[model samples]
Target: MRKFIVAFFMLAVLVSLVSCEQKESQVVDRKAEMKTSIDSLESVLKAAEGDLDEDLGLQMIDAYVGYAKEFEADTASVIYWYKAGEIAQNIPGKELYAVTYFANIFEDHPNHALAPQSVFLSGVAFDKMGDKERAAVSFEHFLEAYPSHDWAPDAQAMLQMSTDTTDLDTQVKAWLENANKTQE
Candidate 1:
């Protein structure tokens, strides 16, 4: 009985140690992946800024978008998108362009690796553009739609803190009335 108890305890400790090691390995792998993504994103962003040809610009954007999709959940996603957005701002006639691009990642790829965070950054771009109302709406939508997401708390805080000067009451009332009628 004593030997059996010792064996069981050893097994349990081994399992616990393995679990912790696996978690640490996962964190290290994620960090390495994020570093690679950042390096790739920085090059593309730099090229996009220096090259004026439409095709080159589009290609750079596409490359950045692809990497952004892959590393969207990685710690490097925010920084990558911010740099991409900065480059995009130089493109003329591209009003709220970054918001639209990032929003599409959330809209079209809701189950994607970076969807929740893409939505959060989408709200951020809107807010940066001085469209606080839409930013709040986007953040609220992120919270309601992705309540279980890793970024939900951040979305909720953003919504609670957002101050919209626009008369959102009218739109909210209209939406509620339509929703109620649909239920009936």
Candidate 2:
């Protein structure tokens, strides 16, 4: 009876050790995959810095979109979604997808540091896509959710500006340009 009990104890210990090792391995693998995705994205962004061809830009945007979906639970998803939104802005008539990407960051990771910016950008994306109603809604949601955020004032302004009938795109573009400059 004693030998049998000892054998069972040893098997349980072995199983526990194996389980721990497997979990550790999974974490390492996930980290490695995230690093690879980030590196690839950096490469694509660098290639896009000078003389970016439309075809290549589209391909890169597609990749970033895929990364955003695949890494949704990962914090790096915020970066992937943000990059996807920025890249999608260059593509004609694809502004809605950028809005979706920005919305994903805010919806899935509301506590993330980038969530407030994502909310504001989603409003801009909707405005650029010519959906004033949705843009207003997004801006309102941003204000409600992040009233103390630095972008709250801008969000309020955007909500009001989205009501205008003339040159909305120009206004939004100017606001985004100014925001970018301020960030720099």
Cα distance off (Å), candidate 1, residue 122: 0.9
Best-matching candidate per TM-score = 2
Decoy 1 TM-score against native: 0.44
Model 2 residue 17 lDDT score: 100
What's each prediction's TM-score?
Answer: 0.44, 0.67
Off by over 4 Å in 2: 50-73, 147-149, 166-184
Query: Per-residue lDDT tens digits of candidate 2, residues 35-148?
Result: 676577567768767555667667767767766676566666688788778767667787888888887788888998888888888788888887899999989999999999
Candidate 2, pairs of clashing residues: none
The clash count of every prediction, one per candidate, is: 0, 0
